[model samples]
Target: MLKLAVAPVPYHWPRARILSFYADLAKAPCEILYLGETVCAKRRALTPQDWLDLAETLRAAGKEVLLSSLSLIEAASEVSTQRRLCAGSEFLIEANDLGAVTRLRGREFVAGPGINLYNPRFLTRLHALGMRRWIVPIELSRQGLETMQAHCPVDVETEVIGWGRLPLAHSARCFTARVQGLAKDECALSCADHPDGLVLYTQNEQPFLCLNGVQVQSALSHCLIDAVETLQQLGIHSLRLIPQSEGFDAVLRTFDQVRRGATTASSAVEALGRLAPTGLCNGYFHGISGMDWVAPPQVPQGQASLDAPAPRKQ
Candidate 1:
């Protein structure tokens, strides 16, 4: 069976809300939980100790807890956090950048989606360095995965960013701070105001992208709820769900049902439309544009269910 894991939160949110959110997640159906500040280092809502404590709590609850490092490391403080996270003997670490991978030498670790592992040679080198698992980068197509999966060592598990807003790019400059007319150094941690990231609209008012401090993501949430069968066929061992502000638990349940063969993919798509912040897309899986959703086999035939309202247009 395909396992479910929740990716670490990408946006900077209040500490109280962060705690409450994870508290709810500890009881959810997710088998694995990737926790830590993987985005801007200045978020400061949780200290390293806070993450360690949360990891222990989740581990006690029978969840496989993995600590993730930042994607864009710009300073000594950020490197220090990475060292501290990797040096720990308690939890497995997910290296989001090459620096983290360098520190994780000789130890089993997870290569996060930020690290570009596109070809067979890349996976082989990482496997030799003790990479026990690798999360497919969001841009890699399904065919791309098929060509690389066979090259991976048998013990190394394969996972994908199965759901959530696609994290497109990261930079040294904080776009969110720039938007607020503040320099990166003097910005007053303003990203907290927009819990789901500030949507960047095109001049004509079409949703184009999102600004999250140093990370720029697609405005449309990248959803693969309709790709369960393809994911299974591709031999993906786990599916990663990036946490969002609303309907997250329901999102997990719907994916869980589809993976278990309890319902059809179209039903899962409809269920996910009700649960996600935006419409679902499986384009990357189908070798199309990342925003396009190619219908899956077994789409439900009846009218949409009344349990949740249709997703609002952005």
Candidate 2:
């Protein structure tokens, strides 16, 4: 059976709100929950002990938890922190960088989407290094996934980003701070102000990108709620749903219903559109532009679809 896993919150939410969000999520239908900050380490809404305690709570609530490492390792202190996380045997660590990958060798670990798992050979190497599961990079198409899975030499869990804004890139310079005219070192934690990230628009006022501290993301949320059967056919073991500021509970319920056969994919797609007010996209799944929404054949007439994209550049 396919399973759902919650990715750690990428935004800098307030401490109280983070607690409330997890408290509500503890009872959600997800089988796995990833805890810890995956972006800028400056946004310390929770300490190491705090994350461990939360992991224990989620585990007690019947959820498997993994601590996620930062995507960018710019400092020795950060490397030490990841090493400490790798040393722990209580919870599995999700390695987002090569440093964590090296430290996590010989122990079961998750390869985050940030890692370049572009080929079967690379995946085989990681598998030899103790990678038990890996999240498909957001930019990889369905066909790409199929090819990689076909050539994969060993068995490993394949997880895809089922929902949330696509984390596109990370930089040493904090884009959010620069936007606020603050230096990266003295940014006053401005990311906490925009929980969903600050949206950037094009000249025509079209949503273009999102700036979240050092990370850049797609303005529209990535969704694959209607592709459950396709995922199963591809032997995907899990759907990793990234945390959002609102309507996530509905997102969970909708995916749960669809996966459990209580509702149709078409119905789930409709519900998902309403949840993501900025609109939903799955074009990356169809080998098209990541920002465009290419509706699946399962969708019926009159359903809300974000299609009619400009012709792809030849």
> Can you write out model 1's per-residue Cα lDDT over 1-314, one digit (the tens) per residue?
88999999998989998899889888987899999999988888998899889889989988999999999887998888888888874789999998988988888999999899889898999999999999998878878888888677889899988888889899889998899999999989999988988888889976678898999987766777767777788788899998888888888888888888998777677677766565556677768778766655454445332222244564
In model 2, the runs with Cα more than 4 Å from the true position are 301-314
- Prediction 2 global C-alpha lDDT: 0.86
For model 2, state the Cα shift of residue 99 in Å. Answer: 0.6
lDDT of each: 0.83, 0.86
TM-score for each of the candidates: 0.94, 0.94
Q: For model 2, how does the per-residue alpha-carbon lDDT over 259-288 read when each residue is reduced to its tens digit?
A: 989999877776787777477788899898
Candidate 2 vs. true structure, TM-score:
0.94
lDDT of 1 at 190: 90
Number of clashing pairs, model 2?
Answer: 0
Q: Which candidate number maximizes TM-score? A: 2
Cα error, residue 43 of model 2, in Å, equals 1.1
